[model samples]
Target: MTTIPVIDFQLHAVGKEGCVELDNLGSEMCQALEGIGFCYLKNHGISEEIINEAFRSSKDFFSQPVNEKEKFARSHNYNFGWVGLEVEKLNPERPVGDYKEAWNITLEDHSLEWPSEKVPNFKPSMQKLYEMCTDLSKRIFDVISVGLKLDVMNCEDQYVPATPIPGTIVVNIGDLMQRWTADKLKATKHRVLNPSNEQQRRQNRQSMAFFVHPDDKLMIECLDKSNKYEPISSIDYLNSRFKATY
Candidate 1:
């Protein structure tokens, strides 16, 4: 069975005492995030109802025949909209495609837009979840910064001007951390599974991933003074490895 480690949010919500404990947790969590690129975040402040509702809505949206889901398929950029099973390829180096169906939503400056007309109630439910999750992600990022002994807001820039991208839940990892960790920690690589597969389809499994990307125009490079590692362009790194096949 594939398992993602669960990091408890409560560990960091209570201030100093919490922060202290989380300092220890951060080491383990960062190691997991670096090695696996995915982890199960338990005790996340978001309500179970919200998580279930988001998943339920996603399942309903993907359950519609392919034609219907395609209506909202991302256009222009590879970022937003509905991605069908075997439609998004994650690793260009690997020939096989990913197996999954997903509905992606993203926010910037706390603003969100969803295809409500097509997926009734999708906009509101997702917006609510995004707000909550964003807050949670920020807290986690802070803990990571402290764990690494960098300034409190050292990692803040990566998430400040959020841009949308796919994966089941929101993901943040980019040039900033690459520079900070000297390539020791890497941004996560995640993909949705094609819902058409018998086992997955039978279980009605569908995923929603929200990736918080840096502003499209932003040029991410390692800081010179912090030159603990070789600098690399974020876009080049992402493009070289990620080729969405669904």
Candidate 2:
């Protein structure tokens, strides 16, 4: 029964009090990712209010009729938009596709597509959350860079998953990071399972995720230079995965 580590992000966000513990914080985070490929971050700087608002907005969006959601249906060319239920097969070997639906918000400079007429706050709340997450990710990368003593920056495990802890952010390492680190870190296979109880099964589960990817044109190579994986462009890698998913 191994448990995912819970790292207090306040240690990194704090000023004078956190200076001495920064290295230890990075080490703890690295260990968690290297060992389990996931960790829960507590006391992250993002406001709880923002997180709640985003979820509320997401729920509202999902509650709309399928027709309305289809107006912004995602395209293979543009990855940001409404993604209907069962549209993805994260685990290719699974008999069926994923059961969840999603709405992707773009990180590009283009105008966002939102059902503002229906859920007015959806745009603002999600935008704010996106910005906060972007900042937090940069900080996390900085810590990892120092911890690994590198000059450049870079699981479904068993049936058990990290239990939900209030005010904590669950960070999962992705394929890119695993390759970038030359297997120093892990990118685990995971899937969302249905609730065990009938009561819970009837309710909709709301979750939010912020994916951080390097520029589309950026080339990704193995950081350790061991050639464990071949170098590829960000967009090319994403396209290949999307092909398998859709």
Candidate 3:
């Protein structure tokens, strides 16, 4: 079995004073993020009920008939709406599509917006979850800035306006983090999965993903440590990865 590490952020939140030790908590987080691109964050301050609600709503949405879910597909923008089972191929080279279904939403300026009108109910639950995740994301970013010895608000501009939609788990790719960390940190890759088989599909299983992108025109580059880290073009990386897997 493959296991991903969960770094408890609550420890840092409550132990912020003690975390200044520099070598202990800071290094630990850096290492974990750089290696896995994803970590389970506990003590993140998002309520359990909110998380549960998002998941429950997602399941309900996916439970709908294929024709119903298709009404919400945003194949054009790749921003918001529903994605059917195996509709999104993450790895082309792998030649295997996942058996899953998902819905997406974005947050901007503390407001939520769905790309398509088909999923009307997406907004309410998405907004609730977005608020929680955005808040937690800000707190985590602050700690990361402090850990990197950068201004506490160094990464603030990146999150402002909070994107159009927000939530408990914000699915951001590795490209932005690579720029922010000068290639030292990675944006993790994750995909939604239909955990149950065909029979369960009738019952409906849905996953929600909230992906954050840098402003369209913004260019990300290496920071002060650019020389130390090898440069990888975000566009090329994404294209290559998608080609190989999807």
Candidate 4:
């Protein structure tokens, strides 16, 4: 397996570093996105306590009986809320759904419903983590945009492995981003695996993802640097992708 490149978030954080550091990190990000489409982010200022709390809450939420989870089933054709295993087939080439349970949250144009009554402090923890991750995402993009000379970068996002690697955030490019950039950045393919052993199966995987979807009506097009594809609405693009995957 190829090791994903890890990028230091502080290099681009305000006043934390200088242009040389930012440009270097940007170059690394550019290559990583174009090549692997996935990277590990660290030192982006999300506290250890917050990550732990989020994970704990997520595990607790997923641990609940299926009925409790179903209450927050996704609605409005939006992808936020609880998604059970065998529901999302990330890779059309694959014959099975991803072997993990997930909860998705989006900052704008919200449709997220939570089982807050059952999971104490769930809302607060998720909100804080979402804010921090979005902050990190935007700054990281700012660095990449500056380096690539794009006006701005989109904020779509996802989660990574569950291991307690200190200060680690897994960031991957989505299909919409791939479309927007005309494949300048690839949409990484990732999945949670079926447990191979009793010990592995005991650890039911749960993840929280912050997807930064652009407004539904906004036109998504290849950047000016590369007009390889025509413009399409973000919603239409997402619908086509999800319809095929689901």
Query: lDDT value for candidate 4?
Result: 0.72
Compared with the true structure, what per-residue lDDT tens digits does model 2 show for residues 53-167?
9999988989999999999898776778899988988887888878889988776626757788999998888888888888898888877776763332223347446678999
Candidates sorted by lDDT, best first: 2, 4, 1, 3
Q: Is candidate 2 or candidate 4 better by lDDT?
A: 2
Q: Report residue 126 deviation for candidate 4 (angstroms).
A: 0.7
Candidate 3 clashes: the total is 19
lDDT of 1 by residue, 102-170 (tens): 666544323434556767877667777877766766777776665553322222122222223222233
lDDT of 3: 0.54
TM-score of 4: 0.81
lDDT score, candidate 1? 0.57
Per-residue lDDT tens digits of candidate 3, residues 158-204?
22121222322332326657665665565655543443677876764
Give each model a TM-score. 0.65, 0.90, 0.63, 0.81
TM-score of 1: 0.65
Query: Which is the better candidate, 1 or 2, if ranked by lDDT?
Result: 2
Candidate 3 worst ten-residue window by lDDT: 151-160
Task: Write one digit per residue (lDDT tens) for candidate 4, span 178-201.
Answer: 878777777766665666898888
Error of 4 at 78 (Å): 4.0
